[model samples]
Target: MPNNKPVNGQKTPSFFDLIDQTPPPPVLELDSKPGTRRLAKLRAAWKASWEEGGFLYQRWEEVLQARHGSWHEVATWIKAAALFGGLSLIVMMVDAAGDIASATLKGLSAAPATGAGDGGGLWGTVAHPVQVFLADQAAHLAVAPAALYAFWQLAGLLGLIGGFLGNAGPRITWVLFGIGTLATIWSAAPAGGRAAATGLAALMWALASIFALRGLTLRPIVHNHPPQYQFNAALHLHATIPAPTPASDDFGDETDNIHPLQR
Candidate 1:
């Protein structure tokens, strides 16, 4: 964004006011998975989350920038997708190889222990429960990477690509969450009361839900307030207040700084 401040005589709304005015992105309530119509659910979740400002999005953006300076560029994200695909293939190959090695070792051990005839091959090997179990587990292990790539990892990549250009949503979401959290704590003051305990419990549940499942984190009640109000009232405490720069005397005077420790 350019640094053109509003000219004189033009009033500008504060960030919080803008947050109150802005509507969250559209969302789908269904659960999602790969190759299903439910995939729309993932799209909705990411869109909604990207819109709601928070520290999580900031950290992810930092990571994206630090590793790939051009993270904001489409070409960079595509390259990332390619790298992830290559790694997934390598992981799948290794998993399959390990399964094969384990099966071979187990088969050799079983053959000697059981003395159940030599080289009868597939049927003979599967005749043992141990072999059957290994084969079944191997089947699962073999497909694990491919499944993760097709579903979760691929979904994450898409989310990154389609993410909001700014962190405004998460920022506003967190700001509201912070105000609600402080109010909750203040109301629950006096250490060991039922109100305090109850508030704490709700806070934990709300946090777990917010982290495990993405969405707006705060809900309070009023005639025309947002949806956060419909849920637990006192549960959203998070922030990003920048620290002030150090003054010369913020630390003890340097004149006597070295003497005390040495003495």
Candidate 2:
């Protein structure tokens, strides 16, 4: 039978037809299947992202245009900047090394003090501080290059991050630096020189740690300053509990007197 309830003078709709025509009751799926829902959404997003001329394609186009266009213009600039940085580092290192080497060479070449305080108390006292200063300077000079070189190692690690380099190469570099730092620390002498050498070792150690840990600690840092949050003064919270919440009647008086049969 057709749906014939006077409006169109058609035959009455059969029970089964009416049932079939009715929309299904919205499913009340109470199960909180977060993983299923999340996975489904992720799959849909992935597919949509890859759709012809979609978000992924548009991003690729933008990147390609930038890389092929402005990138070339700045290519020489990048190389120039890098070259200048490298030359500057080399010059500084060489100057530092030369100063220390020349000072120490002169000291070593100086013939033993003649006349009075030769290899004795007064002369030793006078020369000790000067020798300390020179030793300190040399170690400090070594530290300068060591620090920059460690930073350079970290920079090369960018290749690892960018997927251009493999784990083996960086790992090897880290191992070599680590061993070298250990050796330097072991052989270093004099208080000032040792202190500066320690700094170099520390830098190398930091670099090695960064490489070993895969720079996970270098994640983008987000700084949030919520209006109600205070970082400096609020760090060490000094909260005191209320002097016992004054007792209050939480329940009504009617509950004070009740009988099982009252209901």
- What lDDT score goes with residue 40 in model 2? 52
State the weakest 10-residue window (summed lDDT) of model 2.
Answer: 111-120
Error of 1 at 66 (Å): 23
Score candidate 2 by lDDT: 0.49
Put down candidate 2 lDDT per residue, 116-189, tens digits, no spaces.
Answer: 22324533333333333334445667544233333433443543343223365655565564665445454533
Q: Which candidate number has the best lDDT?
A: 2
Model 1 alpha-carbon drift over 4 Å, by segment: 1-74, 113-263
- Cα lDDT for residue 30, model 1? 65
Give candidate 1's TM-score: 0.19
Kindly give the stretch of ten consecutive residues in candidate 1 with the minimal lDDT sum.
123-132
- lDDT against the true structure, each candidate: 0.44, 0.49
For candidate 1, write residues 1-263 as lDDT tens digits. Answer: 12123435543333334334445444455623344433444444445435434223433564666665554553444578778999999999999999986675455444432232231443233222222223344476754322322332233333333332334444444444334434433443334543543455456535533443354335864586567646556877799999999766636558655554453
Model 2 alpha-carbon drift over 4 Å, by segment: 1-166, 189-208, 215-263
TM-score of candidate 2 on Cα atoms, chains taken together: 0.19
